[model samples]
Target chain A: MTPDPHRAHVPAVVHLDHVTRRFGDVVALDDVSLAVGPGELVGLLGPNGAGKSTLLSLVAGLRRPDAGTVRLLGGDPRDPRSRTGLGVTPQETGLPATLRVQEVVDFVGGHFPDPVPTPELLDQLGLGELARRQTGALSGGQKRRLAVALALVGRPRVLLLDEPTTGLDVGARQALWDAIREYHGAGGTVLLTSHYLEEVQALAERVVVVDRGAVRADDTLDAVLRRVSLRRVVLTAVEDLAGRPGVVRAEGAGDGTPARQTLYTPDADALVRDLVTTGVEFHDLEIRGASLEEAFAEMVAPEGAAR
Target chain B: MTAPTTAPTTPPATAPPLPAARLAWLHLRYQVLETVRVPIAVLGNLLFPALAMFFFVVPQREVAGDPVVATTAVAGLALFAVCSASLFTYGLGVAEDRQLPFDPFVRSLPVGAAPQLLARIGTGAAFAVLGVLPLVAIGAFLTEASVTLVRLVAGVGTLVLASVPFVLLGMAVGYSLSAKAALPVVQVLLFPLAFAGGLFLPPQLFPAWLDAVSQATPTRAARDLLVQALTGEPGSAWAWPVLTGWIALLAVLAVVAYRRDEGRRFR
Candidate 1:
């Protein structure tokens, strides 16, 4: 049978209506339902063994689900058309280590019709000079870049990236974020799994937090953090008060040496002003709120905390 | 000094479409290229057989004056050569491919399982060509036998057909064993099958039960056909039907093993 010729124009790229997967007694995915529309970059964030990889495999047609349905661009997971519409970057760098970088990319490119040109892909990922180098010769960060490049070469409508920045440096990580933004800007959809909460906050407009094989929180980054009500505020101490109420711990100048004391409190301005009135002087005082890391930690802490 | 970074350039907004056939053709070519990329496999599949023929079969012929026995020896070696190249090269290659993530990509592509299997068989047939060509040339030039063009063509055809059991045997071996154990398993089976099939000695020297057991061997049946075609001896006609049956049997085994393993991968 021939594939549908008009799938390239569809807007909603991936729709997992109610997909559930079980490995023997363990439920890898529990009645998970999600949708990724065109021009969207959704982050699937969870700790190890939280079934992030299994979810991607189901969408990529690597493994079948035990119950429910997963539809990619209006076709079943195993459909040839569905597969062609999607590209995947697995956590493990899956390239043949012995092959030249160019050859490995070329080989994977051969699997898809109308793949991006080799030079274009090389230049985009800054791998132009390493084309002739064997994959085994690449550094850990370079290997991860090649893995990302392999997935992008297909110009797929929906991209599934599992820990795309696992071993990358800061610059490399931002460059990947820019590339992902560019893809999204051009109307491609992406579903990524990452342990870096900062990365998810920076790149993904929507996030899904799965814990114990179920969706613990699924909403915008701001919304989920708000749902968990986890907050943090750092204060620069102005007073040398030996004892204080409502302060968890104070660091920096309890003995009156010349260092700033940081106090953790739910109330920020009240404690700072009280210390100032009681013969405390302060400079460069700053208050910080809860980070995504703290919020996520609180959300999944009941499942024995995310390592 | 700091490294200078270049600005990223995207492909122009529009490029032409790539036809579907081009993709499938490239996949097949890449698969075959990677299958034979190893130097050890190349030497084992091509060089080892030629070396065995030179040391074991050719030297004996130089000492013995009987042309008939030498011709039978060449026929048996040809059969063993086909088995070695197909079972060793194609079998182990499939096992290695299974360990890779290639199956996910293969399933993702527009190509079906049938086309992939056909590509593997084509690769096996290519290795067969590399392993068998030298023997055919040397046997025709150095030996006294029925080396007519028709007979030579038929001999090559029988040798290629004899690869069925080997290819099927490879699929089973490839599926049942890990990559590390595959080569050793192939090594243990190769000599036994070759010896039982009369590649090392003529079937006449064996006892009655051994001869009957040899008659059941696919290599023995195939070697007999090659010997009959080469030496103009029509006495071993029973070997033809028996070899064809073994070919069919091995083909069934290959398909079963492949399907079972493939199902496991999907499940």
Candidate 2:
């Protein structure tokens, strides 16, 4: 009965408190702390080897932390009772080579009391046609889909998906996203990791950006995007405007076109105010938030490098 | 963040855990199914001992005609079947399973490892029974090995008892070795233990030093006990001690191997 500071309110479906995990001399999670309330879809965004999978492994109860506590459903993650409501789809899945897709689902589902029907779950993941096929015979995308289907068959309250759509095509990735949304819409919580920023932008409500085995930024999706604080301002001007106040970089008119220019700045509002005060004749003015791509790069930018 | 619900903060309870026997049965069903679907997998264990019974015991009239010799041969090969199945099932099977991508998924289940580990032993026992079937059929039809009804029943029970140490020893091998090393290790251990234990030939035919050394092996102890069960004779005074000692030894090794594997993979 360790003291639970997190037990005061609605308990987190997944909670990690100052958790530090190590592999020999390397720290995979460095005194990290996170909590996901019930029904929250949080995306773990990081570069490869950023400890995203390691963190998920701790939550999934496949590994234990070197320090601190991890609670799943209010019990220690290592306990079987605590994991009953947890489902996980790892980045790489290995299915029994000879087992049929339906059978694999059935085997995993049987661990839970209220398992989804085999055929029904398969249909949801678009693996209905491959239900009878041996998992070894499946295409990479199909196997990945089946792996997600295995995670969902248990109807767990929380799903931990690591790189769920790594190798999927656009169509398959979309189908998988729809299935995930459908599950979430039904009141399930999801904590997923991805190298694909669009994947996070499309599905995550909250984002935790991890780098070098540490949490660099954790906030809502918009906040994480806004946290980079880089704005792209595009305007059509008769005169070049590359070196205006607050502009970090700009794509001024090329030799062939002088009327269009794009400028990037940290303070779009101040830049705009400066523009109007300076009486720069500008039309077609537009300001946009940093895309997650640029946001991630800037947030986890190399040490000692300019922001 | 706003609380998602006013529901109790307690962990979501699953339906009370399933009965242990039923869970074990579920695991056993798939374990057996996984093996049988690949028919060649079964043959790997059943083939060698049946072939031994065919080539070594069947063609010799004197060896086959004498009830004592023939019955001892039957018992020896029967033990071989158990050891073979136990070793390959745990040694090769468990090792290969650890390398599979599905392994972590299964290990993460709420059913815990008990049901699955029990089911593995159960599957090994079931297949061991099958491994003996060909030899048993050959003994009944092609040889003159004979016994009373009571001894026959006792022999079956004794075989089950004697198989325990070997099963535990197999698990040690299974948990400790990688799949690649398991095959050659099983082979290297299997034949020597079988030979030194008087499983392939009687200990009475061995040199004194070899005979003394054979007395130390778990397989030799098993053979002595099984032969005594099939025929109303006293096994060596060392039989129970040998079996008990090996069981304790192999149990420790198996446990250590299991923990080491967990440490390597997940710690």
Candidate 3:
């Protein structure tokens, strides 16, 4: 099997071409293609089981795609040499309970050609105090911090982190984010997946929204946010204006009595103009920009409809 | 403590990859440490054969005093110890590790599985040696079991070599089944195979039909070889061939089970 010729020209640190993965009858990833360039931080945003983990696994060489090729550092992912420059933190990792924090770090770091010292790695992750503690004794947040720390020990060229801060508190999450930012700043490519909209918004320069085993949108974070740039118009109206022009969706207590109706539209001004021209009786009208959460919800709504 | 916002400078010189021996030793050290911390696990493997010697061999005057009988009895028990260690350590240990999240992390490392498996086998062998110690002491002090230094050395060698099949069998069970199922399966297979192989009773005591059947089992082959080494007797003609065949079969099974498990979980 030959390497994908076009991928060589693109300087991608991680590349997948028409990758499809299935478990029995369920398609986990369907004809998905992605390329992450050197030093790029790409956030994979999706709900649970949205093929986010599957995609990361494929690139990490932890899983093989049912069809298509996965390349890491211009080498086939299945080769151990290809993983020499790769580091991954799966969604859940069970550290050896009996090994002290420092020993575990040292053991894993020893495998890499250029690994950060154990103490330095621990200090960077705010885990220095717990270095002597057995991993089984550490709290959930502390363990999460250590897991992320292990991913950085190798000073990998590209890091794959799956919900690195899932169980962390606000303070721990911030600390982890700082550590991640520092690594990325050092010219490391990173692909991270998260269900937390704020985490991606706060960290990712590029966003890939996945749902129902396919990429719904992939572009710069600002571009994706712009693509979902819809305003929500909420008001108490006496008539059902759900089918009004320019209104993408409208729902409320449409009982013919005056009740609050929330309408989603690409152009709130046009919806309001249409409402006014029709002489609809309304009150307490308010318009607000859609949040990233709302945009994410709209992106994945098709999956719900298919069900 | 607050974390450093700035990334540290890269090390001036990258360290070379550690030798496989060093990695295997490191793995062995940690595995031993972990098992030792759970003192009961160590005690269990150590005491079972020792207690069996004290109760079964120590009181039998006819068998305890005769050099040939005592030596054979002690050698058989030592092989029993190796079998137990091989079965429980790899079987239960691998099954338990499969349940842990840590196993995946180790599996994903650049270092291949050989070192880890070697370390595990080394750990089991170390425990197997420990398991035989009490029996050796009891045989030396309480019973009149005696052997030449060369015989003792050869007997130990035989014990270690004979453990290969059981170890592979353990791995096969561990990788093929869940911990819940593997535990009982190891236990269920252990005692019956031990009895049929004449680990507890002498093969001479078995009926002709049972003794003929026992000759084909790995356990029986192990016992025959160890006894031959210890007592300077000619082992059954079938012993070497039977053990070699079992080792070959179990090795293939172990590899298949390992690949199947890896495909199911990691792939």
Candidate 4:
């Protein structure tokens, strides 16, 4: 169950307006405001201590925000009806380790109106074989898979997952991605926070960058990436000549040794032409666009440029 | 089968909506089963007092009052129930729940907090009862300690009432300590309380100062109440009042601690 009361709603489903949560002198969430629509899958991205978990708790209706009102589905979070529409899988391992997979699924399913059948849910997550096995016997990846299945059994209108894949292997991570895609395909809204930049880029359509308990950027992945021009361009010879339009800085082996230079440029075509004119026989020439990772890093970077 | 053309009996009297009362009952039932399934709790509740009676009272055929033997056994078993349910099981279980992210899961469920609280209290009481029954049977059959129906019922009532304070105390302990730490604290408290209360050994057998300490312990008051109820003998005029006071004090402390812990300030 979520420890926050602000996260139980429908249209404008989750509202955290000027919410501030302080633990003694240290403020965990400082006047944070964010919202999710009925069927939007929003990815919350931040580094450690970025208030990602705190924000999720605020929306999940667990913790009461100190300075703000969080209305979920047009009702108070403590309202029983409002809770019926919400499902949460917190970062902490919530399942009883002694219980078998099927038992946990059944237990959680019993709380909802029309839950997915336990066997069917297990089969969907590729966990049918492990249904009778104790949760303690599962690997980290398997436990995560089971957690995802637990969240979905409720047929919830809004789903909250906190670091859903914190300890998953590469293959298991993609498996979870497929599951998330299927969930969105069914028009279910999802709110998630993850440290995995690639996972965020691949799964979330809209990204919200939080740092020091505040939203630094709330935009689409493309829009946020356009905010900064940190592209990696690998070129042979590249340039001894520097005057290229849109090129901020260029450095390379002007002497010899494959003559490669990295160009920090917004324009790739013009730089390529300048390289051609310089008559520095380019071998491996490729222009890489700015990834979400760099955009996220730039957004959350402190005054000292720390990620 | 008579194919009688019956009037449309209003869709065969559609079943009434599942009552909230039924949900509460089912939740309590589930909690009871889960609590009772713990083997150590069950063993301590049933076997501990039986063992105490076998070792302590059974060997001494003639004591100051052979009838006091039955009172001693009932008091021992009653205290055992309290230690198992209120201190050991309740404290450990609450710690486990706190560690889970269940606050979010359950907070989002349609279940009321009242039902959860009710289920916990009910489970603790039920486990205490299970612990007391075996000792009652053992005293009757093996020791040949005779207790009338009314006396037995009164003893059972006293045992249950005596457990209220312990249950509340257990709740406070549960909220105060993490699961790993709660178990050891429960064990440490159990022996001193059981011994101090004069449940296993009589107060006369203890040192003069220890007997004074026994008079203040909840276990002592509870034991006195059970002993009076069983033997039909009153020790002191203050016994009943002191026992009742202990129950009230423990109840207040338990609820206050629970309300504070449930506020989620620490989390």
TM-scores, all candidates, are 0.75, 0.83, 0.86, 0.75
The residue-by-residue lDDT of candidate 1 on B50-130, one tens digit each, is 676667766665623366776676677777778877777657767776677645545554444445555666667667767
Candidate 4 lDDT over residue span A1-307, tens digit each: 1122234543476767788988677788888887777667788889998999878766666666678878666566655556666677744366666667897777667766567878888887889999999777888888888888777777766778888888778899888888877776566678889887777778888788888888887878666556554665667663353455666555564764556666656677777787678665777778887665764565576644422
Which 10-residue window of candidate 3 chain B scores lowest in summed lDDT?
B5-14
The per-model lDDT (C-alpha) reads 0.69, 0.80, 0.81, 0.69
Better of 1 and 2 by TM-score: 2
Q: For model 1, what is the error of residue A25's alpha carbon versus the real structure, in angstroms, after optimal superposition?
A: 4.8
B237 in model 1: Cα distance from truth in Å?
6.6
For residues A1-307, write the lDDT of model 2, one tens digit per residue: 1223255676777889999998888889999998888778889999998999889888988788889999888787667777778788733457888888888888888887677778877876678898899888989888888888888777788889999999889998887887787777667889999998889989998889898888887888887666666898989987677778788666656554546787778799999999999998889889988775775676686555543
Sorted into a CAPRI-style docking class, model 1 comes out as incorrect
The interface RMSD values of the models, given in order, are 6.8, 6.4, 4.5, 12.4
Please compute DockQ, using alpha carbons, for every candidate against the native two-chain complex: 0.18, 0.25, 0.32, 0.19
Sorting all predicted structures by DockQ, with the top scorer first, yields: 3, 2, 4, 1
Task: Report the C-alpha lDDT of model 2 over B1-267, residue by residue, as the tens digit.
Answer: 011221122244543555667778888989988998899878866777788888999999998999999999999989988887788778887888888867777766677655766687778777777777788778878899888889887887777777777777777887787788888999898899999999888999999999999999999998998899888778899998998899789877876676456423433
Give the backbone clash total of model 2: 0
TM-score of model 3 vs. true structure: 0.86
lDDT of 2: 0.80
Tens-place lDDT per residue, model 1, A1-307, is 1112133454356777678988778888889877676657788888888888888877877667778888876677665556665667643445666678898788777765567777778877888999999887988778777777777777777788888888778998888888777777666778899887878878888788887678877787667545544333344444553356545434455454555555545455676667667666566767765455765665665552322
Question: Which candidate's TM-score is highest?
Answer: 3
